[model samples]
Target: MSDVGDCLFCKIIAGEIPSKKVYEDDSTYAFADIQPKAKVHVLIVPKRHYATVAELAQNDPAELSHIVGVAKSIADDAFHGAYRLVFNTGEDAGQSVFHVHAHVLTGEVLAE
Candidate 1:
């Protein structure tokens, strides 16, 4: 797992790396995915780095809830509240970045 010092999402949150920001608050940051999977594919992440969703949930569930709220807001604005929230927990689950994030997919009808 990548540490905060080398985490890509950490850099984006810290403004060390450029991102197409969609929404932000004291605890969360939402930005467009570099490789979008949907018409409106945004990644919502906590400002604090957590290796996985399990870790985040175990440590700070409120922040996880806040991230979901932010994702809902983004989806609501982008596609009338129809969206899919995805959390890839680990490397085997396709979580490329160690920092916990939610993939908000919306703006079109999604596959089941």
Candidate 2:
């Protein structure tokens, strides 16, 4: 898979950085977000690095689908089949990590 230089998520995927991996496949990786916003917060990413969803959309349709599909599986298996999926595309949207990722959120933490 293609990785970006100095990308945090990329390092996590490559085993250079440790992460609490929840799920992984050839095209995607899922893990707990270090800074979580909900009780069950997981971040799902495409194996190939993309700074934003827009970038990912331009590169591979199947990659995008794989990321979302894995996120769905995470919720279905761990979060009782209910969760919110979020994507922060740019600086204005609070996207700290440049690589594109989908956040899976569930439980009362978000209700507060």
Candidate 3:
């Protein structure tokens, strides 16, 4: 496993940073956002580090699928048919954390 050094999501995955965990499996995890933008704001992250969507390797498709699948499941279960999945690729796209994550946002119309 990758060391949870300065990575916030890594810390969350390792039980260092406390989060309102929603879902977790061997390779992925989901939790509520510390700073929520909607009534339902969950972050789905992978156990391994992948800096951003643009940086994701083709070999990591399964891991990516697992993260996205978890996010979709959370949206289906918690939001109950209304949610949007967003992946910010880099700083220009509002990606604050380097670790790859899918934001499952719902309960309000988000500005495009």
Best by TM-score: 1
**Which ranking of candidates, highest lDDT first?**
1, 2, 3
**Global lDDT for candidate 1?**
0.93
Clashes of 1: 0
By TM-score, highest first, what's the ranking? 1, 2, 3
Off by over 4 Å in 3: 1-4, 108-112
Give per-residue CA lDDT, model 3, range 60-91, as digits (tens).
88788777677767777765666888898778
RMSD of 1: 0.6
Encode model 1's per-residue lDDT on 7-98: one tens digit a residue. Answer: 99999999999999999888899999999999999999999999999999999999998888888898899999999999998888999999
lDDT for each residue of candidate 2 in 12-53, tens digit (9 for 90 to 100): 999999999998888888899998888889999898878899
Candidate with the larger lDDT of 1 and 2: 1
The candidate, 2 or 3, that scores higher on TM-score is 2
lDDT of 1 at 17: 94
Per-model TM-score versus the true fold: 0.97, 0.89, 0.85
Best by lDDT: 1
TM-score of 1: 0.97
